[model samples]
Target: MTTLLEARGLTADRPGDEGPVRVLDSVDLALESGTLTELVGPSGAGKTTLLLALARLLPDARGSLALDGVPAEEIDIPAWRMRVALLPQRPTMFAGTVAENLRVPWRLGVRSAESPPDDTALREALDRAGLSGVALERGATRLSVGQAARVALLRVLLTRPRVLLLDEPDASLDDASAEQVRRFTAEFVSGGGAAVRVSHARSDDAADRRVRLTGGRLEEVGRA
Candidate 1:
């Protein structure tokens, strides 16, 4: 498969009371189309930082990143973001009905109506994310943490991004919900897109290649 995303010598740091604290250093990674890769690490190991950098949400230090054979910096940020979607560990939902929140992107004109997915597509996406269409018409603020996460995932899927970046998406789910997340991720990649997941679960089934990050560096972990 062809490479969908690549990062070379990526690094990040932030100002601290002591000095600059390095979050990521000399990180190199490549993700292929139609594959799901996992970045595993302990807390504060820069897994999220790496994901943000790859999504073009954070600027890296002294490295190059490319998406779909084009330099990341050369692409329009908003367009790049449309192609690469990020689902943060804590997703924010607007104060409205779940369907309203799901339709927020559309209402904001972020997505064009000509290509709008049908109701069945939306329902299927919600179902695959372990949510029912009923939740769509309910109040978003009333959803449990896991339900919120599922809604976030479904919302991103509606955008039809070519690359999906997930940060600990299963952290708040039960076993059954987690399994549904795993299945949906697998199916997403199987459909010719790519995903990079940051997970701590020992038995995650969504990754094909796994890498471990430690002390600001990354090393390949065995196959998933």
Candidate 2:
């Protein structure tokens, strides 16, 4: 498999009342194309910190990150973020209709040149995310937690990121809804995208690799 994203000596720190708290300790990770990597660890184990470091979203994170073998320093941050999208646990809904919220990516500088998705395309994406009943004109803020999570996921999918950084995407979902989330993740991997998902539940879904984080250190648990 081709290496889609690589990280070496990744380190991160968080702000505390006393001083900076070390969250990650020189962690290294590599993501390959057409694979989904499951990240599991106890609470406060820095699993989410690692994902944030990988996505270059943490201001205190320091490391060497490369995408498709290109050094991160050479690539613009916005461009890198566009290719490597990070979806947090809490879904953020803009103050607008569903269609408008999904169209946010196109309005960003990174996707400015790309043609925005039509209503037909949006509806199809919603259907795939198990949100077909949601109307495009419906107020995005009114969606239930589960519904909002799927919509946020669909919003990320519409951007067509190469590497997806998902932080507990299925935590708020029920069994049926969680299954749909897993299916969407599988489809993304099968389509040649790489994903690093932080999941607490034991997944029956297929994943190429499993990594565990403990005390800011990473250990390989197994591989498919």
Number of the top-ranking candidate, with TM-score as the measure: 2
**Residue-pair clashes per candidate, as listed?**
1, 0
User: 207, model 2: CA deviation in Å?
Assistant: 1.4
Q: Candidate 1 residues 72-117, lDDT tens each? A: 7799887788888899999788999887777766765556643655
- What tens digits encode model 2's per-residue C-alpha lDDT throughout 21-106? 78888888999999999999999889888988888888868879999999999999999999999999899999999999999999
lDDT of each: 0.83, 0.90
lDDT of 1: 0.83
Off by over 4 Å in 1: 59-62, 112-115
